[model samples]
Target: MDIRWIFDGKFFVLDGIDGFSARTSTRLASDEEIKIDAYLKQVHSAHVFVIDDPEVMPRGEIEGDGLITDIPAIAIGVRTADCYPIFLMDIKGRTAAILHAGWRGSYKGIVKRALEILFEQFGISPGDTVAAFGPGICGNCYEVGEELMEFFPPEFFRRRNGKLFLDLFEFNRKILEENGIEWIVPPPACTYEDDRLYSYRRRKDKSRLISTVEILPS
Candidate 1:
């Protein structure tokens, strides 16, 4: 239920509590301040959408895994159960982005692709951007298939008791750091371990936690 701030407090990032799903609504409660102005259909793809006009305010109609916008008051978000909800913001607080990075999206390079879009569309450089990860299945709990070993580097995978686990946080962090981004904030909690957040891998819950970020209105 606690809210976290990032980007030198110019922006606030929130990870939703259990039972509240963005698939049903944007605000966790009617009084919630960080109301999501736009969210995606979230197909677990690496595709990202650029929101430039306010008329396209609530864009849940779009099918993509990532969203970026410079417009203040327009909170963009993504829903996740065990997948990581990654947040991105520029140093000057001029732009913000949210990505839904499941194994499929991450393997397809969602983080790297979002960074490229930030530079190509908004002229925001990775060096000027800071990132924060929301609660997700931790490396210790995320068991995976052997085929993943073929896609991700060996360092991201762990073998224990004949099972393979993937460190999604570290995998995404490598992409972030390799692209020149620094000041990464680790997740506050692990979804699968922390009962406060929803986790599909743990309970097979149909509900998801919505993670959102908004540039404070200037």
Candidate 2:
């Protein structure tokens, strides 16, 4: 029920609580305590969810790790437990997007796809937009097996005490930079280490934190 962080002058990330849930895709509400309802009333926003399965889109559903929009007050969001939640905003073009990037989604280049959509649809270049990473598993606590090391380059992986850790923040930052985006905000907290945030890696809680962004109405 508590708001974790707000950024880009409009976006917000909510912390997880028991029995707290919101419909991320369409059908906004006002009584769930997720705060999406309050945001909807404030700016008349819409919501969307990212589905991991490709075949699930047939049942009036949408599937993607990222969602972007130029439409004012459309609150685009992505739910994550320990996976990185990234927020992208083009203040000049009045466009914004939110992405849920886990290991698989990141490996598949979810952020890149979001950036391409921003450029193609809103004509907002990478350098013009501001990108920020929200709470997630930090590199120090995020360890992976040897097979996963093949996907990331040497710079993203670190060997400590005979264990491998992946620097997702840096990895995603590189992706943004490679596309010409220089204005990036570092993450505020590590979900695994921060008890205030929900982390699947730390607690294995099925509850997810909703990271969302919506442009104020003109």
Candidate 3:
């Protein structure tokens, strides 16, 4: 369990040691310290949902890749196995978001869509935003096919010994910087290489790791 303070709230990154069930492991790992109020069905799309009221928001029923909220004590989360889990926070505005950034979701601009929601709904600017990335398959371990070349720019792809790899962190970082988000916490361990974490690409596992964020009660 990795916990940090962001947006004056708890941001947790749970590994796959106990099990991949978010409901079970996440609560147990955190010792019931935090509760995930909202999450998504995650269809690898750019769709983002705004949670103005957690009491009314559906959990795990909506099909989207990202979730944003400004409400206090209401945690938002995303599940991933190898794909990146991105946490976005507007420190000054007390808003936070969690994104499930898989290849399809990233190619579809999930990060951009989340940022748009922060600005449009909360009036939070990019300069006031900060980002943190959880475990994911690193570029060195994330080999991709030539078909991806049609979606991502050349800079995102790298060739090593005739094989191509994609850097999802850099891809999303570029989008954030281009929009004026300068504070980005460098990504941590690689899910594919780290056995403690879950990796669908490495083992075709159905289980997932859950990363959540919330606004602390004021």
User: Which one wins on lDDT?
Assistant: 1
**Poorest 10 consecutive residues by lDDT, candidate 2:** 37-46
Rank ordering of all candidates by lDDT, starting from the highest: 1, 3, 2
- Writing each residue's lDDT as its tens digit, candidate 3 over 75-141 gives 6788888889898877663788889998999999999999988888789988777777877899898
Give the clash total for candidate 1.
Answer: 0
lDDT of prediction 3: 0.76
Q: Which stretches of candidate 3 lie over 4 Å from their true place?
A: 1-34
* TM-score of every prediction relative to native: 0.85, 0.75, 0.85
Candidate 1 deviant stretches above 4 angstroms: 1-34
**Candidate scoring better on lDDT of 1 and 2:** 1
Look at candidate 1 and tell me the lDDT of residue 38: 88
What's the count of clashing pairs in each model shown? 0, 0, 0
